[model samples]
Target: MSQPVAPKKLRVRGMILTGGVAAITIVGTRRSNITQKKEVIQDAHYEVDMISTLETRRAGLMQARQQWERKAKALQERIDGNKLRTIPGIGGTNGATDGSASSGK
Candidate 1:
């Protein structure tokens, strides 16, 4: 009878230890999943922010490109005007082949 009682007690203690181990494993897995989910959410937010920043920079570059194009066009117009002024007989009806007034005709 003494031997049988000792075996029963040992079985119960073993079952309790097994149950504790199972519970700890489950809790650890849950915490790891939660941490992984949080990391995924943070990564999603960072991606959106990065995309928005890139889009803003692209828009600014496009605006700067348009402004430079306009400046280039203005400069080209000034250069063309200077070219026309340098051409002889293109300024007026004056017979001066050079950029001076004619004495006779």
Candidate 2:
């Protein structure tokens, strides 16, 4: 029993470490990259850069959540609320383009 428990504990600990690293890398590293990508040489430039950064962050977070929901759905196919939540473009009923508008339209 002890021998079997040791391997299970080790695997669980390893999974936790992997999840932590993935979370940090996905959010932290992408945030840093966005910071490096934006250049604010003028007032309008700063506003545009900041707005774009915010939008990117929003979209990234939404995508992450939707991915999580997809995984949840996969693991438990009968989760009720998510079935109605509509993840959009990734196996959910609604597409992401449903309410989007073009800049000049």
Candidate 3:
């Protein structure tokens, strides 16, 4: 009887796995760096965009106050608007502005 042919070795599988792990490692490192840069603001979990928006809102509040004062007797009823500066943990409004941290132990 003729000898059976030997099974071929699938060596390409190892190379493929190595390539995939390298790609994942590069991508994960890049993503981690980007995420870390985003979280270095003064406020707790406040991104750069959030701080910019807060600045804009403060400017708007100043303009609103000016307008409100200009029309003192315009028959306006007393109403409390959410100034957003008082909301806890909302739009960079952390409960403790005294530099206290609440991060991982």
Candidate 4:
């Protein structure tokens, strides 16, 4: 009887194929990580811009509020001055300034 033919050894080819696949996987993973980092940076910049815009709007509103308060105070002072002018001896210490004291029974 003839000797059994030996089985072919495929170890070297299998190792090369595995190494190629591993290199591709490693490169793909690195690229994906870089993409994720870029997206995070962009999102952070967008949030900063939104906060800056809000601060600018808040400053404008505060200035408007202060201006309105000043106008309201000026108007109140004018009204108080007019009331003082219309009333005679209001807040005076003398008792005769009051009408009831001046009129004899």
Candidate 5:
């Protein structure tokens, strides 16, 4: 009967070294990929926060602008009212009466 032969020591050592190198390479690649993904997530979060802050500032500015526009409109209306009151036969009876009294004199 033929006996089974064991593998040579040099071939066994070479195979172990190759397997160890392959494992280290795979682990290193995975760690690099995980780090890149974390960075991407952080960047996305920062962008979202920036956008939120800008939107809040814009909304506040718009509200302030609306208030200023309202105040300006009210002021313009008051000015127009004063102008009408000063003009003859436009808003006040005092102007008509004074004009008639002056014409009669």
Candidate 6:
């Protein structure tokens, strides 16, 4: 009976080297992908934090605007009241300019 043929050593070594290179390439690609994913996650977190901060600032600005408007309204009303008092026929002033009563001749 014929003997079984044996595999060549040089061919086996080449195949092993090719396989090692392929494995290294795959591992390197996966590592780069993982790094990119980590950066994306960090960016997303940063955006969320920034949005929250901006919203808080906006709310504060809105509240301040409302307070300012209320104060302005009150000031305008006071000015209008003073104007009415200064007018001749509004009944706001007694019309005694020098603390003396005028008599009609």
Question: What do the candidate models score in CA lDDT, each in turn?
Answer: 0.91, 0.80, 0.68, 0.84, 0.86, 0.85
lDDT of 4 by residue, 1-105 (tens): 233332223566678889999999999999999999999999999999999999999999999999999999999999999886845565565544656665555
Please give the lDDT score at residue 80 for candidate 3.
Answer: 36
lDDT of 2 by residue, 40-100 (tens): 3466688899999999999999999999999987768666656677555654434545656
Q: Rank by TM-score, descending?
A: 1, 6, 5, 4, 2, 3
Name the 10 consecutive residues with the lowest summed lDDT in model 1.
90-99
TM-score of model 6 vs. true structure:
0.73
| Top lDDT prediction, candidate number | 1
Instruction: Please give the lDDT score at residue 33 for candidate 2.
Output: 75
lDDT of 6 by residue, 67-90 (tens): 999999999999999876755443
User: Which segments of model 4 are wrong by more than 4 Å?
Assistant: 1-9, 87-105
TM-score attained by model 3:
0.32
Give candidate 1 regions above 4 Å deviation: 87-105
> In candidate 6, which residue pairs get closer than 3 Å at backbone N, Cα or C atoms, i.e. clash?
none
Give per-model CA RMSD: 4.5, 35.5, 28.5, 5.1, 5.4, 5.8
Deviation in angstroms for 72 in model 3?
A: 34
Q: Each model's TM-score?
A: 0.77, 0.36, 0.32, 0.67, 0.68, 0.73
Query: Clashing residue pairs, candidate 3?
Result: none
Put down candidate 5 lDDT per residue, 1-105, tens digits, no spaces: 233334466678889999999999999999999999999999999999999999999999999999999999999999989876655565546457455546554
- Encode model 3's per-residue lDDT on 1-105: one tens digit a residue: 233332223356667888999999999999998887776644455666788899999999999998888676343322234342365444454555555657657
Q: What overall lDDT, based on C-alpha atoms, would model 5 receive against the true structure?
A: 0.86
Candidate 5: clashing pairs of residues: none
Total clashing pairs for each candidate: 0, 0, 0, 0, 0, 0
